[model samples]
Target chain A: MDVALDTLKFIDLTTANIIFLFIVGFIGGLVSGFIGSGGAFVLTPGMMSLGVPGTVAVASNMCHKFPKALVGAIKRFRYGQVDIKLGLVMAASAGVGVQVGIKLQNFILDKWGQSGSNLYVSLSFVAVLVIVGGYVFYDAMTADKSGKPEAVAPLALRLQKIELWPMMTFKTAGVRISMWFTVPVGFATGMLAATIAVGGFIGVPGMIYVIGASGLVASATELVIAFAMGLGGTINWAMHGMVDIRLTVIILAGSLLGVQLGAIGTTIVKESLIKFVMGSIMLIVAVSRALAVPKYLAELGLLDVAPGTVAIMDKASFLIMCGALLMGAVIILGSMYKARKAHARQEQEAFGQA
Target chain B: MAHEMTKKQAVVRMIGFGAASAAVFGGIFLFANPLTEIFSRGGMYAALPIATVFLVSYVHGGFASNLWTALGITAKQPAKTLRPTATKRPEVRATLNA
Candidate 1:
């Protein structure tokens, strides 16, 4: 029963494509591992550039994501970074959010066609990345300058004080905000995942600012949220026959290894460094999406640009996205290298003292 | 203590899990077309992909962890959570939203 999906055609796996997927998957997994969310923003677009349709790319990425999130979550939980209760509450609401977001995406696809859907995805990427990415970056820079840990956001402190009924406390996160406060963040995470195939851009910050989780706990917990988002999303997209299982499995082969390295990163670096990496990548990815927007707009006849211009824009966008991946790899690997060196030197000193 | 898995033990488990992972990937590629068709059938059959992903994560995740441990890239002396998992299943159970 070798059935083909009508909306998505699987491209032949050339040697290059296989190598590319594994490499990209590793980088994506690494990012996802450290921040508890990422890789999808890169992987989805990465798949699309490799000739997969937008929805198929999203679906395939989602298929890989839940499992990745599961692995990352378990790893971080062992370190006491994940709050299962918080992740669960957020994930439940995120499920509802995913349903709503997917409905809107389908509606756009039906009404406006493929280019429109593509344009919608691109615009969403730019908007979310710019707004959320900018905020996260600002917070990271300010925290770094303060030469102290991320000072608890006063908002988080105040929100925790609300004596609402059913106050939920995450012991690892050391936060006691009400369930009322947590669900909306989860729901929004789901919605973002459905639309852009990524929710951690919002989920991590939401946990930090609104729910009072520290950057480490917030990021680790985001893995749980990512898993929930991915599970619900994969189901929704698969039910529509949009998933390219080939892409999913191939990406998994690389990401599985990358994610472990990334999860180790959290232990090696400061919490502020996580935010900085997360923020820097987000802002750069936003630029990448912004570059692609005009191409989609011109395709829809919303702009009168020449076809060559559109092609150029598309190429530039993909290249820039690749650059974003490179930057992420450099920062992550670089940090890991430095941390390992410091750790070794410390061990050597301790031995000498003994 | 770090789950009592020695570096030597981790290396052995890494090889074991690595072989299992390779087998699974080999099976998928060898039977790619049929696997895709069944997994992408759409409907409650979504479970096919979900379950596959979960299985892959467990097997491959184990490999990655062991690989790291064998390399000595573990957490800093791993301060285990002496506290039990404080919050149980969904927080609403613990919540008193009258």
Candidate 2:
């Protein structure tokens, strides 16, 4: 694999390219900080569009991801939101999930070739995001309407009641459930992550709905899982000599700054806002991926589509993907601003009363 | 007392780390070719890039964290621990009927 990897060309960093990577990195970091996982899904494709080989883009993006996760995990830890034991527990199972995911990917690539693989990935994104993201969004809206910001899923409550073998309690997440239940959620998160680079989409929601962690805890705890998985993934890619250090560093510059602001944001905003933002981004990205499906279908010779139309759809898909990240950033920042203003007003009222 | 830094101290540390981080990035661009050659060699050389990212992240991540605190964009401290505002029921009176 390393010998084969040697032949793939890495892109030169023109000033324009460097600037683009830095800006995308910041937005991606900001989103990841708020939601627990994002940016890589955009960064990998974003890099490739700039003439970077697919493998190099993935490898370099991965190289930056783990460290960023490490920093985020630490920052959130100070706020007492991270559940280290749970994150490690889920990460252990996610490791197995990644292996299975890779096997499935290889199987698809072998059977259908590149175009078929593309279609499969896109459809998976649509199906999973629509079902899961819709549920999360609906839950957020319901919580808002009822004025109950913290509501556990019925499934989680039932699971917690059951007296099963090896029940573990996560103090920070405030969850006591059978270890067996956690495995499936963790495994699914890993599998999704393997299929799509952003496993946090499934991982965070799985923690909230299935494991019964609050949105803040779930999102924060995800950084630990991300750090573990990203580290392993980076090492594997690096061993193949696929990491482009320059791109890794350039992206790192922006993401580090963005992630810290994101971590602070969790402290100021309502927990449900995390779900609202995560769910919104997931659905938008799903649509963006859906738009690319026709292009892949045409490539597979299943649909007779004009080349011009395919090109237009491709650009639309990429633009929508970028829009999803931007939208998440705006929501997070807007909520933060509102919260800060409210805090200031309360302080003034307290002073007046005193 | 030693554990706490004044705002001025924090700003100074942030500046120092920011400069160091910038220097590291500048060095990477200056020695881009040689570093890439050494890093891309698989096997034992894989550690080169891994170590480089870890080192760079430490300095840069520190700078970013300090910059936020210095700018007063810090996390909200939980108020629950400081307040004892749990409301008590009003006292019941056992008086003769008027």
Candidate 3:
């Protein structure tokens, strides 16, 4: 397939297209603000669906993401959810992880070209989502059964016990662990993020189980890591003239709105709800990526699949990705509504007392 | 309670956001021809997208923040039940040192 590089001409964008990008950006932003990492997964494909080249879509999305993450981190900071120190530490190490991830990605690209690289990414997505999502779901269920609020994992507790040198304490996250443990987890998260673009699945769980951060703090901190990674990636892509600014700005428009609302919604919900939503999205996203595996396998001739079947599978993959975002939106909106009502009732009670 | 901005304040924010967004959109439109031409210049062409992203993040980012405030969707104080401390922690001894 001849990939036309000239397809990225700016005049191709229309007013209607700009409006659509803005709306999508807002929604993507809202989801990220709440969940810490999501908008890129949706925005990149969303732009591609509108005829933007794949690389251009990804590049433009990356360009818009860092600033949006910056905005989100600031807002969540005001809500007292962010651990700037932890986030910065994680980001620093995650940068190295991203370099490693890119090196691995380039190696894969060298060997397999585009299809093989896609296969590797989809497979990793499936593997990580299933393993991590299942564990989170099972944990959430067990916590519910025990009638205990979902607490930090025992692994985190045990890790904290290891009195290694440089016992850094994340006061906001309420954990004291060795910098050794924290750095590795942050690096791994960055590596996975560079590969699949959604590092939160690994980063959040890693923080909870390995580093002992609360779900809220872990998720919020992921935004900072995301900011660092996105900024770095954007500069790399921009150097290639691959970024479509119009597309990026449009997505930013929507995402910014979505992210702020998502951040605010965090104030009203229970910690377990975060786990539940994260688990649910991860599982669904796993299935979505799983749908793409066969197509890649077919391309590699590892399997004999029909072309029509491949096309259908590709569409299914896109739908499942959208489904993941929709599921996330539903959870955030539902929880926010409940929280808002509860807040109003509390205010009314205070008024009555007065 | 929702912060009820006086009519003047509301108008000012509205106009501010509106003008900024318009200017951004207008800038993109006005430069559409030249920007596209420069972007395709290739080689050291990386700066075009980098600079554009920074510009968008600033202009559009401000709009998104103000837009959220206008929508009555703002962060509330942490609940009394989950009032974790927001204090910064002191640095711990390095593992090798300890």
Candidate 4:
């Protein structure tokens, strides 16, 4: 009975640690709510730093994510944003992609050891985030400047014309594309999720540019994918006795509140703001992960650096990651407040006219 | 169409669910040690934690939704019109590529 409990390093829940987890969970959930996929990237690391083992942190984080996602997806679904068929199809393939990703990860870990594995993950994070994040950020800026509605990418239009067999239509997403086209996007999403713990970074953009879903639909549908992935992952982890329920519930308590607020935000802002927020966070996180590259390199004997310097870089990287989350939350709340005020004023003027 | 909830009804439901959520969380903390052991025991016991979160999410998620509504932080009116409507289409069956 106690055998599984004895091996894992579960932290004692002090008042301070609980407060920290709650605050981090809230902000992380807020971002996840707005963009469809986030929270775990910060939550897992935040827990690990609190002395919870890596696997336990991951398991507990997954445990919270699905329910959080279920709530968010439902809330967004009411807003007419979620596309269930699209989400289910992508999730089906994402499930397979996860298995492939895990096998690849095990191979890397075995060949290169911890430091090597860490280096590979960090490098991949930097590469994917910069290339994709940059394009997204640039797109957001240009669209905002032009003051034009979001145009479907030409790539999506071309793919839609392919006349591939078994074509499917996603009503909510307002796209008719080959089911074959969706498989790779979902697979890449799962692969990235297994590697970086935030597949939305790829999944959301993939849906927008490739599958031709609007940003709103893409982000909302992502919640469905997250829910499926989170549930599947939690069940697997639980079988190994890896989930720490205490940590899971405490985070859930805060995230549940934050996610509802985030769902409301989608209604208040323009759809392009979703891209702006997602892109901004991605770019910042890429820099933070990049900083950790040197430390991992030093550990693998590929680079020489003072222990103090490596330690400094590690701390800086974590702080920057936290800052990125905080920045995202601030932008979301501020925009929500401003939009609400303007909306109220408009309503007041109209009432006076009546 | 579903009947719209009055402001008064929103307040009553928010308080009810909030109290229930707090009580559940408090009870868990009260019996923290033994609960943690049983919940993390792997195998059949894994269901305990999964079920617990599902239960908590229902209670807490309900409270959170009502809390926002009571505070007048609800979504904009005519939310259905905010996004584009999906076009009517014929259903397609799943096919595997050779």
Q: Residue A62, candidate 4: how far off, in angstroms?
A: 0.5
Candidates 2 and 4: which is better by DockQ? 4
Give the DockQ (2 decimals) of all models: 0.35, 0.23, 0.31, 0.38
lDDT of 2: 0.86
Off by over 4 Å in 4: A1-8, A144-149, B78-98
Give model 3's docking category: acceptable
Candidate 2 chain B lDDT trough over 10 residues, lowest sum = B79-88
TM-score, model 1 to reference = 0.88
Which scores higher on DockQ, 1 or 4?
Answer: 4
Candidates 2 and 3: which is better by lDDT? 2
lDDT of 2 at B79: 18
- In angstroms, the error of model 4 at A228 is 0.4
**Which prediction has more favorable TM-score, 3 or 4?**
4
Model 2: chain A TM-score against the true structure? 0.96
Tens digits of per-residue lDDT, candidate 4, A1-354, equal 123345355778899999999998889888888999888878888899988999889999999999999999999998888999999999999999999988999999999999989998999999999999999888787775333446777788788777677788887787888888989999999999999999899999999999988888899999999999999999889888888888988999999989989989988877788899999999999999999999888899889989999889888998999998999899999999998999999999999999
lDDT of 1 by residue, A159-207 (tens): 7777787788777776777888888888888888777777888899899
CAPRI band of model 4? acceptable
lDDT of 3 at A352: 100
Q: Specify the poorest-scoring 10-residue window by lDDT in model 1 chain A.
A: A1-10
For residues A184-232, write the lDDT of model 2, one tens digit per residue.
Answer: 8889989988898788989999998888887888898899999999999
Query: So what's the TM-score on candidate 2?
Result: 0.92
lDDT at position A114, candidate 3: 90
